[model samples]
Target chain A: MALQAGKGLLLKADPIAAAFREEVKLGLSKTSRRPRLVGILATSSAPSKFYAEFTRKQCEDLGVEFILKKTGAADTGDLGEGEGVEEAIIEANEDANIDGIMVYYPIFGVQQDHYLQQVVSPYKDVEGLHFKFHYNLYHNIRFIEPQSLLTSTVPSAASAGVVESEEPPPGTVKSIIPCTPLAIVKCLEHVGVYNKILPYGDRAYGRTITVINRSEVVGRPLAALLANDGARVFSVDIDSIQEYTKRPQGGADTSQRRYHPRHVVHPSNASLQECLAISDVVVSAVPTASYKVKTAWLKDGCVCVNVAADKNFESDVRDKASMYIPAVGKVTILMLLRNLLRLQQYKAVN
Target chain B: MALQAGKGLLLKADPIAAAFREEVKLGLSKTSRRPRLVGILATSSAPSKFYAEFTRKQCEDLGVEFILKKTGAADTGDLGEGEGVEEAIIEANEDANIDGIMVYYPIFGVQQDHYLQQVVSPYKDVEGLHFKFHYNLYHNIRFIEPQSLLTSTVPSAASAGVVESEEPPPGTVKSIIPCTPLAIVKCLEHVGVYNKILPYGDRAYGRTITVINRSEVVGRPLAALLANDGARVFSVDIDSIQEYTKRPQGGADTSQRRYHPRHVVHPSNASLQECLAISDVVVSAVPTASYKVKTAWLKDGCVCVNVAADKNFESDVRDKASMYIPAVGKVTILMLLRNLLRLQQYKAVN
Candidate 1:
């Protein structure tokens, strides 16, 4: 089954293009009084090139200022014999003219810790990955994370739904579901699949979801969010789960059985096949070069979501499958912009 | 197949009783200071008649003094009547010369809330039912609640394990497990069942456990405790589970076929039976004149825990059950004494 599954990018060419122009027009009116300078710092040419071009064009149309700062893909000199990315970050942090600063680390292997600590001021750090922000999350304090912001922008581009245009507005909260995973969940809901087993005709209850990852940016907080929606959750580390089941003497009792619907993390090609074979819905976040799921592994009507942009689609049963979603580019940027507008409105009122 | 489960009781019989006797002993040692006073307030004639005679004999043996405050059987207003009990409670609360105060309310429709506020001071509210103490529970602030103190007394005793100990050792943060339930859980543990489930098992991990009530004093907190111990929990109210599931159309996809092992709640006897039939372990807190569970309903070798004191045992099932545990009195008293002693030690050190 060649499934059409991937990230769902709700695109509106005319309306979204017009909305960007309108935001720029409104933003430019206030620029003379307080120059709204957006800053971009990136270690890779790819992300920097993409964001800089996109943001600069929007800024120009809105009459807002855009500044691009490139810290070439190299290690900080203090850590090794290489260019100092940390030094560039310090410069960005001290720049009084910058209204908002974004640092992009495109590849997974890059070590950005030193630069992260040195370059970002809490107020200007639009990503919200600073130590202070993380500590607040640990204590269950409410604060926006940059990833959440970036993920909402694309969905906000669609013409305001009836609920969106209600009095006082529904706020960005409803529209701000996690881009990749929420896209998968939304697809399931659209196709009359509510929860894992039961289907709701129209109104869907928030389904109990288990996410198996604890990386600072994704796993823990996502589990908390799912649990807050009345979902009983079990979050396990990928390595720990493997180690738990591989133990000698028939494994520990904890790994003996699966009694509930489970979500596994960053499954390998083989593991993905096993998970897809049993799951009603499968979501893959691993950045791979090709499709991990095989056509035969999925249940006939299962939903498959692929968020790995670099991955190629390959599945014989795609036509026979229920639905497949494809990944979209710069989806995070759209989400971030929507979040920024909401935050601005909140700050204005509160 | 009749299995008798071990049960334990905790009490502060040694030190507090010793202290009472010591006062009497010291007063009798002097001819001038021989007028030692002891008073009793009884809502039931049974305790008044029995304990009154016992105290009089103890006083006479030490050649001290004794006094009895009797609300006589005819004037023995219904314990469930809040106004009448409150009046007696206020009288006890104001009596200055009384060394210690004891108020007994029978289980026969006693309105505990009616007298609780008027009868107790934080210090002398030996029963720990006072508003200030109960409110502390809401904020998770620790204060003595007399009933909790009394119920915990038995576990405190059983924890001694046949050792004739007078006082708990200093600096003990006593684990005051509620006696009847603790005994039941411990009994199961002793039989090597649920041994793999540790003290800190996360119920969200999906172990099916059904608790038959949600009373904070017992059912709800115990459910939370079990869930914390890694058991998937199903809590049912004794009165509602049947009607909740049997309503015409079983509104809103409420079929047993949709039951997930994660967790469920049923509040009627029939639904509780359905849950029990499928459950690995069943905990009953339902107040019934006779056994609510029949031998046929239980799976062979299933663990049945009865936390209700008044439920009558049916001989057929009671004999064939893998385990049957009886409620032991005075455990709560032991738990309270240990807590008080531990508090005293901490106060001294800190």
Candidate 2:
């Protein structure tokens, strides 16, 4: 599954994603009905259209139901941009047959796009962008009673407090995490970045990572997920650098509290060079083609991951990094499918 | 307002809370009806009973309506612990006359009490423990459309994005923050810990803070709040230490995103001495009387705030600190009342 380059292993998303694909297939085989996913495309954007087609191909290959609902400029040439997106989301929300809903983003940019995100009911939101899921993601509320999604009450004793097990507790299910972040976590797990011997929530302990972006969709949430899992994360964006960690200077007594406060942030004044010098792993998602992480700055033998559509690492990245994952897109799609399956189960339980 | 002690100036909550008291009084005077708050005491715990009395006196002094609804063990000799607490909460939630609801803690300990917290409607939840408000606090969604509370959609363009203004955007209101955290922020603000000259939302920029204790109700949320406002906050709980910050090493390009990802967490292996040596401010809320932050470890001229009922700082705290605040109980009560006023406004708009 690993391709050895001149200096280090160059990894692709296929092998990591294949493992999840099998899991999804097995999940689908056991389900009573095929899970249906509705992808809403409302823009004339090239990337979004390509993504929609790509999603359709993946869904078709997996034998899951895929429906593309194009509106506004993406529809017939006469419509305005992002027009009828709300109605499309509402229709998908009301459709009992639709198990999951996903919207191709940047149709109207951040704020408007965020509103469209919320309009998708949390019950069927495959993207996991709804505020309910986002809240859980940020707070590290990993498992929840499926019934709690419909009502505020804790349905049973099993759902009373945080359960440390990876598998959901009795009468509870794993809360949906954002697909991209989940994909990234899965990638880290595949590459031995996550230490299995360590405790469940603190698998990334002792690792210092630098994630070069703070976009809500990927970088910020990914940083939070890693930090919550016990990593020292340097979240780099265009303006400033912030460090994320679960264990700060003085370790707290675990006996008193029911759950660990997931992670905390500390403003770092260190330069990119300083961060790169110390980082055990470097993940760059800078979208611009012009942006490149200097190979010379990276810590030798560190793992590197490039999440951008455009390569964000220099030609000689392998000279320093022990391993480099070119993209996480394939794994991300598998995560989306996985979420769809989970949402179906959620619906079934409710 | 500041009394010169043996070394540092002693700061009291009286002056700090007094300012907020006038603001609440003024807000009450302008309202058409007096704001009514219901405090549900369901425990025989001494602290809870004392706190209820304190809350009543404060409400009476401010000419606000206060109702003590004793249920379970606190009500009479016959009732079991936490009995009818959920019913009491539901009653307060449905009562048109009740503007806010606050339940005394440790009624049934962590999990059952957490469920009881969820039972309080967000509309009347002055304590801000409801998952909805906690979500907003953790995500740094400072201003929300008042109407957005009742519905999922954004009510207007004004409430679409994060607004940096201290004043709520038109048609929006400041999302309620947990009382203890808000009280700490206010204390920091009163003592000039918040730099007014800086841009809004980042007023705590460039300061390093250590917050001891990460309880869900106080420590964890306070750390998030401070970090969101651009302070580097070290969140110390019993089992672990976490660092919180909005800015990392390589700054994000501000032009690319609508809002900064509030804050990210990093697990630090640093000892308590290391954190204290660099911290510009130290706020401790450790509840145990035996738990005392060593004064000798503090950074010279640092500000110290004690938020626990029993002082968590050593007797010699003033030796190293430039300013010492003994307690924030008064400030926390005021913040609760302020939340009650805001909730009333929230109801009026809905």
Candidate 3:
């Protein structure tokens, strides 16, 4: 994908998502029964409705069973906002046939919506928002025994700081990563941002990237994922700009070191312009329509990915950038499906 | 506390620890029954034994019930190393009389010892090394309902992005912080590192700190705690230098931000010299006896703290530092006692 004069390659999520889609289809084909997914839509918001429809279409295309459980205002205006969301989640959690569960967020906004996230059983938590998964993700514990979830004890891998193999250990499986972050990672990998020869855990080493927005679902985890894989991630949020990295300078003796420096946060005073000036990749997930990444500030020939519903980059972003991916929704959906397939297998062993 | 020519104030842990010891004593006075803490010592290491003895004396002086449960090598030379530790933890978990449980770590080194950490019940986890607490710590969830532990849910505060009050909500209590990190924060607060005039969560704002070592027990959590409290923390480890910070540069509109910008990780290329030059406070927890912070590299008038059993600072560190705290062990013990009291209340409510 070479850039044209004063224009970059406009990349679509289709090819990246399509590869994962095939993998999910292959996973579904091996399953004894079609995996079932329950999506709880508690709000009448347009985005939620659109997402539910999109999920349904994807599920139908892949031959996976998907049920959209619309509650509260999403179902009927007569019902209170976010009403019955908890009950719906409980019902889905109890249904052994339901291999995965996803909730359309922002129904009751931040706090209550977060509470609803935890309400979903970890076994069926396809979104990977549950605290258990979050704990593993943040700590960089990549693999876990599915049966261990039933036990109160967690994997000691995070504390152990051992260099883990890409392959899961005996009787263990890859832990679920949040779909959006996973999607972003997969997209980056496809674009050759993750150097394949640079070892499994630190594949993105030597790359400095700036991620705009530090939202829990996307920005923060994406920053963590990239940093864990050895990218310098500038985590741009509303009030702060934090740098995330797994690399430490001026190395000390590591013989007795207990914990691997998993993506540690550092305070940065660098402005967006400063970050963009040096960034090889700039990913913007800032949701608001007004937010825009100035093309002039971007590093020449950088890769720009727009993750928000509205374009976070200016119209001329591609003019300076080597490649621009407008959205990752397709890749995210496939990642969710992949998680659903994994959860099904997880349920089988447990 | 004026610094002498070519020397700085040598601050002792006793004075700072004494203040918290009284607070713990006051908390103990209110309890109808003495809070019982079971210390599981599975390691025969000299340091572990010394720590066990230290904890016993502290508990004895404070009028709290302390029981030392020696297992494996700590008990019998014939027994295998780390043997019976899991069983001992299970026994403590079942004991209604035990308000808290703490294990002497490195029993079987990092991995197995971490597994032992999880074996200790969250309700009885005085060290706050449990995944639940670690999740809360990494994500900056300051409070949780005690009864919520019984359920599968977690605090939504981290995802909510709301500016939390210092006081826990009506039905909730302050979540247990890892004792060592809490002690460090308390010591900093005592020495005027934390600004009382600032809002509750971001007290360590406007400070740049360098924490040597990214060990699970001390260095990592301490960095997270400081960064979450609004300090720019550079987490220095054997192989990497990562920046930890809550503050972001080039602020965005916060109207619909779903998650508060928690302590974020950024990869830094800075050497120890560079970090020390800019840092207002320098905390070293590097375990090796040979490793030392060069006296000449430190920022002028910086507060120096040594958390390692072996001093990490050069003998002449005080020449440039404003104050130097050699150890926090005494303060850490008080924090443990405080957690025990809190756990007692947490258990009662649950």
Candidate 4:
């Protein structure tokens, strides 16, 4: 089991999970109708099945109904061949009973994302990957202060009557923050990592979090989320990990730098010695392949989130840190269910 | 002058600007109707006028007509008080000759983003912040390869009929990357920094670029852009600069740490002694107030982008680095024109 490696510090999320369930139950009762979620799985791939099944369990346990819409047809979203998926999306979009719609990502062997986004209405886009939803996320127009970017200091941007507005600082846009990252953050908070990091005893403020992968599903979104939440994110990937170590090159010119002399990345052997040395948290998404990392490199009791297929950390590394395994994956599902239920209630009232 | 700092290194955007004009000219000639752009200056703010005029000059220089629509309305998008703006958008959308529509951002003293997004047609959205353009950027669906995120792990994500597809790696989803960051990148590349850092002399593949502010407009977007382009981004603001300076805490635990133990920020005097010590590029967005940064902290020739209003660097600091000033901010205007022209051609062809 993924949790087996975390001798005792793995942070059994039972209490947080229970509280989320209670909140979802309360929200479900407040809704006008039963909050239903339709998860469309267009592939029977093992990973897809595993994730789909996990979602089903999380939803069922939270009193939300989950319907698995499976398709054997090899309809790719790229070739515009997702007729079945599109029809299903249209049906769900119009379904009054359905509060949210989540299409399992990476419809394996095919690409139907375009069709899915087109068919699924923004109102039901719980995944928030649709461009319509991104509008709210980007929030195009932001109020500039009297002293922000372009101001009255220069002869350039100081003439047409610009003034300051009372709008408070827009810290970060949360609409673009995806679920998996949110889940990891929630788990970290639940485990008291924020208490250690932030003065307010909440929010991941001023902490150094390292995202060891750059994938669309997890690393990319997580990095964005952490950076917005007032934490500095150091993102290192397989193609670019070697460049991140911040080697101590004292007054050294480019030609005389201490590292990467030949510019070749030794993937499995590349040492993130400096990165781990400073990181308060390490979220590793590199899967299966054993990476040469030592627990001593990280600060004591550092939070580790391993979102890989076979777990990104070795047993020795996992045992020393607090870890969230995406394969175990209960916390993120719980989080999504809680959000969906709350969104349903909001929809019902307004 | 901002260009004075980089006597030998200040990259002139003349060639890039000329190429962009040629592209726009070609696009305009290919279309049945002449390509025109509407510039909506809903405020008389000096900063807004300055930006609007700069854009007008660029457009006129490129043989494109620019019309400035001035309004001093205190309308809120959420309140639906932007009727005049909506009408103008409707007119622009219907006008086939108007190939692009540019709305000067932050109509000072009004909250009208929702109104603009709902009214402006996506085809005319030259800013690419519109949800329609973002769809191509977010690209809702992705194909799961047998490799990539995880591989060959049983009982993981392996059941729901998943299979591999032959799609090449998505080069980069660029619509979300705003113009300022792109301009900063172009400036850096033009200054020969990529050649200094990246292998094969192309792009910010593996360089450490520090963004000094966390605003929604510049710093946030720049960090995301740099990270996506494979650079190590260390973000710092006045409030958070102290936490970033890694002072080599050797099991210092909590008390013996070098800084942030008291959780108080020395805003005016806090030196980023450690951050600049390692950064290859420092994008400073803090305005008016000069930071207490020292020349000795940085290695020779660290690129600095002083986006601050009155300049954040001193003569001593500026003397050692290549800098870009918003006063001679032709790169961003050039980038936007390039995007608009390409978008125009794509719309015309499609």
Winning candidate number (DockQ): 3
List, residue by residue over B177-213, the lDDT tens digit for candidate 1: 3323433444444444455543323212334556676
The segments of candidate 1 whose C-alpha lies over 4 angstroms from its true place after superposition are: A1-48, A51-64, A73-84, A106-111, A114-119, A131-214, A218-227, A230-281, A299-302, A312-317, A342-350, B1-350
Superposed by TM-score, candidate 2 places the C-alpha of residue A314 at a distance from the truth, in angstroms, of 1.5
Model 1, total clashes: 56
- The model with the greatest TM-score is 3
Residue A28's lDDT within candidate 4 is: 74
Looking at candidate 1, what is the lDDT of residue B50? 62
Give the per-residue lDDT digits (tens) of candidate 4, residues A222-252.
6655543445557676644422222222355
- Kindly list the per-residue Cα lDDT of model 2 for residues B112-225, writing each as its tens digit: 355456567778889887755765776677888775565432223222225457897677688889998999999999999999998888889889999998776788789989
lDDT, residue B2, model 1: 25
Q: What is the DockQ of each candidate?
A: 0.01, 0.03, 0.04, 0.01
Give the DockQ-based CAPRI class for model 2. incorrect
Query: Distance (Å) between predicted and true CA of B162, model 3?
Result: 33
Go through the candidates in order and give the clash count of each: 56, 43, 22, 26
**Comparing 2 and 3 on DockQ, the stronger one:** 3
Error of 3 at B340 (Å): 5.3
